[model samples]
Target: MYLAIATDGVELQQPERTNELYASYWERLGPDEITKLLAEHDAGELLPDFNHVMVPVATLRRLAAGRVPEGWDDDFAAMLAHAREKGWLSEDGEAVRAHLERER
Candidate 1:
């Protein structure tokens, strides 16, 4: 999932918004593997004026409100554990680090 951090605010970005998406990173998750951007990709520094912002992990869960299958709890938990180990979670352990990817 990708969260776009625009000049106005942070929100979940649609896949079609390919360019100028001041937002987060992407993940290629598989049964035994997960790949995502590096921590350096956290793009709050590229923000024009607002403070460094991060997309809350809670939001990610929200996105799963009606999309995931009936048995994804374990997978979700594993993802969270991985995020924690990488120090990608916010101090409260609620947000995930994002990246800056725009059309340059």
Candidate 2:
């Protein structure tokens, strides 16, 4: 399971779909743990596990353009770098809808 966060909101998701959202490291979390994380996010707490949150390419672009929430844990650069390293990012750092491209 992974926590998917975007400009819309957060959700607990299985990391299967490529273009659905950005996925983080695999962790078998219980429902209670998921709820706690969501609650913490709603309460504006900088998630201690913020690094586990993956920002989609679209959201990343918005973030770079100052169009999204700015209260993140200042891990944008690290996340972006990780994305690039993992081939989850486009050449220009924008959205890539195809999983094949993502794997390339």
Candidate 3:
């Protein structure tokens, strides 16, 4: 699944006024990385890094279909909620940024 990692304390507005302030670091996690993420999450090691992780809605759906990795519980839920509330989640939950007016 793909994610759009965001930078903190940054805001760049687009003409459409969609608040495209957050610069996204697009990533598609391999199995090993996904495993590590789950491990870190379970161990409470991901709190400091949680804000950077912006799981797309599609990825969220994929995760829902597959069983959540063992040990991912309240913490994961909280982060997902935060991502959604913070507008980090992509509209369709896909990492498509072609329409965003990125700052070069």
Model number with the top lDDT = 1
Best by TM-score: 1
Worst 10 residues of 2 by lDDT: 95-104
Candidate 1, 1-104: lDDT as tens digits = 46543333344544222221225423322212111221233322322322224555666566446665665566666666776777755688777655545333
Segments in model 1 whose C-alpha atoms lie over 4 Å from true places: 4-53
Indicate the TM-score of model 2: 0.29
Q: Between candidates 1 and 3, which one is better according to TM-score?
A: 1
Per-residue lDDT of candidate 2, residues 24-86 (tens digit): 323544444544554555411222444333234543343335333453324444555666777
Candidate 2: where are CA atoms >4 Å away? 1-73, 96-104
Q: How many pairs of residues in model 2 come into backbone collision?
A: 0
How far out, in Å, is residue 15 in model 1?
A: 11
User: Per-prediction RMSD in angstroms?
Assistant: 12.0, 13.2, 14.5
- Pairs that collide in candidate 2 are none
Candidates sorted on lDDT, descending? 1, 2, 3
lDDT of each prediction vs. the true structure? Answer: 0.46, 0.40, 0.35
